[model samples]
Target chain A: MTENRRYRLTAIAVTLPTLMSATAFEAGASEPGLPQLDIATWPSQLFWLVVLFGVGYLVMAKMVTPRIGAVLEKRRQTLDGDLEKARTASSDAAKTRAEYESDLEKARNNAAEFAKQAAMEATKKAEAADAKVARKLADKVASAEAALAKAKTEALANLNDVAAEAAIDAVAALAGIKTTSSQASKTASSIATKLAKQGAN
Target chain B: MSNSEGMHSPVAQFEIKPLVELSLGGYDVSFTNSSLFMLLAIGVSSIFLISAMRRADMVPGRMQGMAEMIYEFVAEMVRSNVGSEGRPYFPFIFTLFVFLLFGNMLGLIPYSYTFTSQIIVTFAMAAFVFVGVTIIALYKHGLHFFSFFVPAGAPKVLIPFLIVIEVISYFVRPVSLSVRLFANMLAGHTMLKVFAGLAVMISGAGGLAMAGSLLPFVALIGLTGLEVLVAALQAYVFTILTCMYLNDALHLH
Candidate 1:
């Protein structure tokens, strides 16, 4: 619709000059309304206006516009790069967190297992030490008992010899007896009985 | 001529005549008020900005702050439309916006010429934009820039007609663009001047009619405010169109 309006407008504007021309020829026509196109007079002005516009345009489009577009493009790239970096960093951090958590769990489990093993080994060593000490003590006690038994046997033999000597002396001194076998036998019996009585007393 | 001469009254009785007329090689060169003001506009703009920028500090004073604000405003405009890709063109766009803004504002000063009021000046600027965009489109797209004349999804059989319409529209770009800024400035300023003149004339009559003059006085105040808005709008329109042209050059769409 706008395009059609513009077209109609253009047609009217173009036909205007021609219509004015005919109207002019019909009028007094003393003064020419439109001046003849004088290339020398006005085209120079138009030319310079164009030249100025061109220079201005070049400055804007070539120099100015491109710089602005560049800044925008650079900004876009920077933002994109920053976003990617953030994403990668986040993913890396997540992976590291997961690895650390798993390693920590593994370390805790290993520590618990090691502690249990150490405790069991300590208990076994303690038990072995107790058994060795008990064996040594039993051996010493048995040796001490054997020594006591030997000492007792020697003491008894000494006591019997002393008793027999004393009896022989007493008989010989009391009866002026000869050292005869029968006398000796009787004396031995008496002595044996006396010794038994003494032992009893 | 009678209509124009009669229209000159109710404003200033003063008229500008060429002073120090010198026809240099058959070109009528005269230092008229218009020429003087054109030079004055250039000088004033240069002096103010240069002086303001002279003692530019990281922390700005009033003058520097104003200058910086102008720079920032134009910079933001370029940034928004052209995107960061358009940063380098900041100077041209900035200059165009500033010159037009200053010209429009300066005319609002008592007894100052409005250069933008003249079609020639406005058209010159628009022509510059039109030519610049064309060159840019061509340079960027090469022969492919011609493809801009063809609309997308346009049927093949209708191609020729669309091309003609496109060409005409393209040619009209500068005319419409230039006239919009020029016509708005001229019309608004002229209306203000006429109303103010009426207010002065009516109050001079000095009666109940003079009491009635306060209405125009109030309207003048209102119009002044509107003119400021229009001035800014004109500058904005000029800058945005430049951006749009730049957009076409870059995108070829």
Candidate 2:
């Protein structure tokens, strides 16, 4: 429908101008050769030009440009928003990655520290056991030596009694008489004391 | 001079003929071919610009892109030439550019009236701009607007001479502005019509002369191409000049 109206308008526009210039130009051939100099038409031209141009300005300012400007504005906003979203997401990713890397690094450091502590503790325990074993061996040897010396001292103390008994037995066998035990012991003691004096002389 | 009938006279394209005879308070305000083409310019521009943005899509189609591009072009022109102060006059400049652009382009159609070719029409528009700019200057700067006619740095001895020249040139703005556009459209279309008539005339001679019509035809084709450039260029020229004038009005010198 609009196209048909346009065609009609174009048809009239093309045809009427021909008919117009046809007569107007023919008349101008006799007078001044330009019909634009025809002062009579100036008012209408100026009038309609203002009217149509005013109409055009209204249509453009009030209608057309605003819509175009709006669309441009909307597109620009949408693009800026999308870029903002992308930037945020990128920064977030970088932050997360850094956190992850730092976490990993901390964990690795902790593991090494634990291992070092464990090794040191184990070494300390081992060294303590070695010292204890050495101490135990030295104590056992000293106690055994004391026990041997004590046994030797005890055996020598018993030797004197045995000598006294032997002396009593010999005296009884040689004299063929059963002297009193006290007399025998006294005799052994006297003999011993005499042996000691001779040795001192 | 091919003074014969049937599109012979180049000035014929410029003639204004009344289509609707309207009387307003005893004045012959008849709507002529000039009015018709003017209406056509408005209609085409309105339809094209409006319909192009009917969807107002975020991503524009072909026509929509063109509409946006035109909008941006005028906006940037206003921004660059007239600065931010001219933002208020953007619609006016945009309208003028679109109007003239469509007028000049539409007239390129064969048998179409070249309304821009008319001195009366171009002068009317120029006169309006001239007067409007003067009013704005006067209003904005008060009586200081007359100082625009004085040369800023001229010697005291030559001040009068320079002021005379400046005032004459200042008053001549409308004429120069109007005549420049009027003569451009008038000459381009006249040349096209004249060459076209020559081709027609030569082709009528038949035989050898008929083949020779190709020369004028080729030239016509080239001229038509050039005229298309001129149409858009002249529209830009008129509009940018308007911006400059408006700039002068809002900002002195």
Compare the candidates by lDDT and give the number of the best one: 2
Give fnat of each prediction, in order: 0.00, 0.67
Tens digit per residue, CA lDDT, model 1, B1-253: 1132233332221123355564545554555554445555545655676676565454567986676677668777877788887766677786677667777787777777665665556777898789988987897789999999999999999999999999999899898888788667756776686788678778877778899889898999999999988988898899888988788777877
Fnat score for model 1: 0.00
* Residue ranges of candidate 1 with Cα displaced over 4 Å: A1-201, B1-22, B55-65, B79-89, B139-142, B207-211
Q: Which residue pairs show backbone clashes in model 2?
A: none
- Report the poorest 10 consecutive residues by lDDT, candidate 2 chain B: B1-10
Per-residue lDDT of candidate 2, residues A57-165 (tens digit): 8988898777887889999999999999999999999999999999999999999999999999999999999999999999999999999999977875455456778
Which pairs in model 1 have colliding backbones?
A68-B84, A68-B85, A68-B86, A69-B85
Please identify model 2 stretches exceeding 4 Å from their true place: A1-31, A148-201, B1-7
Looking at candidate 2, what is the lDDT of residue B73? 99
lDDT tens string, model 2, B101-190?
Answer: 999999999888889998778888899999999999999999998888878888899989998998888888888888789878877887
Question: Can you give the DockQ of every candidate in the order shown?
Answer: 0.05, 0.34
Docking class of 1: incorrect
